[model samples]
Target: MLLELQQIIVHPGQQMLLKDISWQQLENILEEMGERRAARISYSNGWLEIMVPLAEHEKDKEIVGDLVKILLAILDVDFEPFGSTTLKNERMRQAVEPDTSFYIQNQGAVIGKNRIDLNIDPPPDLAIEIDITSRTRFDNYAILGIPELWRYQKQGLEIFLLQDGQYVKSPFSPNFPNIPIVELVNEYVPQCLTIGRSQAMRNFRSWMQENLQ
Candidate 1:
């Protein structure tokens, strides 16, 4: 026989208070439980939300890393990868944690912790989101000042490139025109777990080496 679990209702802003409990109190509770992954926290307007990854959620991170590796090997661009860092707009008093982000070398840039101080500068060159569920707003990139944003869903990949301070649908990437978004998503993401990271990377390299003419 199957058993049903009860659901608990939580108010929108109450979750953040959990973090305020003493670290020692939390540690004691955690000691009796299985290992838990760290949570990524952010404040949306005035609501606090925390993102906790499942133990088996490594596939998304692996796929993103593989994409970065493939891009670096195929293109001669310089970039650095950051995962889930807090980006803030002080003027707007908003903070966001992008799933994956990158910075191009020699660009006017500033970095922050818990919140990035944008001052008057624009966002990063690229931001990637792996969407398991629908988001409340699709215009997060615009609000964050991101120039390029890619969202990967089970249906396919959506590419939004910012132009003239607005987002537009484009067939070619403004940052890397030669790399096709759809093809990459179709080819690499589905095969991430089956082939394993090293072998998958080797296969990707071989494919790119053959096609990058």
Candidate 2:
């Protein structure tokens, strides 16, 4: 959604400079909730957009793929790392695109393209956001019913676990507490800008081996 401010000039002798600001909010509401939905939101100065994946996004998809491949090589799991998508709120009439998202093995049940028709439902299990700007209000995760969220900002990582319909900072995760996400992110993210994907994967593998032992 885009919002704009307008200025109108009337006559020459009778000068009239009328200043008017206009804002628009766009919402995509569904009648029945589907597997997922992706949408964008606009704010003044900056916007908070989320792309709910019918499938994974580009770089994020690649990252999740690598992580899953590495994890499967080391651990015994029958699942694969699903892609990220966007989500929306019909009741509140808001939309946001999470930076990165995923559905763990067997979590999706079914998958399709086009768009996930979410009438009203809880969001994905994990939503990742790269915080380029400080949120004027608390992050919009809770409003969308996302169970857990990982936010990266200022070279620091914060994990928020949803409890009692609200988000609370917790080191313990009900879903993948044993995964040590913080350590993995800390080690891998820095290398993202400097190294190749293969090298990063090798380093992650090495780190996992040491940690597992």
Candidate 3:
């Protein structure tokens, strides 16, 4: 059992890449590791990468996640938020644990699902990734077939929409069809830093209701 342990640390609170690891092996590793705050595992083509997020990474992740929630609330949209839930597809040879994920258009499909099987269940309508340190490949998410992905890095956000078996950088989110996600994140994330998350969220929601309504 000791010999089977093939872990190597590339950087503290960053990434650990392993080669020739099977899906079941990766599952075993995650199970043995148990629950960890802000830890993410990804697999593609027999290569597995484990990520341990840092403090700044989590701060940005929370800010982006909060903003999305506020926007949903403002629009009176029906959504179910799943934070850092492990998503995988053995057939696709892909897996990921997003910083935050949501079911909006597909909300009813998974309302009572205790275990999600991507082969049958629809993937998250939207997934958010905060890339302060470790970068997630768009190709991996593309393979997973998530409809929308929001990636934040260097205070900039990029929105990717899955189309025709590939990801395209889109100006707007498919989930929030009317909103410009990049502009929204840039404008409001800083306000959270200045006025605090709760206050900023409150103010943004009020503004949205007044303007959007």
Please provide, for model 2 over 3-121, each residue's C-alpha lDDT reduced to its tens digit, 9 standing for 90 to 100. 22123222211212112212222322122223343322322212333222222233543564466457656765443233444455555444455555545443444244334334543
Winner on lDDT between 2 and 3 is 3
Cα displacement (Å) at residue 187, model 2 = 1.5
lDDT of 1 by residue, 86-148 (tens): 565645545556667777642435444223456655566777766653242345457777877
Alpha-carbon runs more than 4 Å astray in model 1: 1-37, 55-57, 105-115, 133-137, 163-166
* Cα lDDT, all candidates: 0.58, 0.50, 0.81
Residue 208 local lDDT, model 3? 78
Better of 1 and 2 by lDDT: 1
Instruction: Please give each candidate's TM-score.
Output: 0.70, 0.61, 0.91
Task: Rank all candidate structures by their lDDT, best first, as comma-separated numbers.
Answer: 3, 1, 2
lDDT of 3 by residue, 1-213 (tens): 354443644454668788999888887987876765446888888998888888878898888898888888878889888778877888988888888899999988988765566878889899999887788678888888888998998759998888897888888887777766788788778888898888877877787778788
Model 3 clash tally, residue pairs? 0
lDDT of 3: 0.81
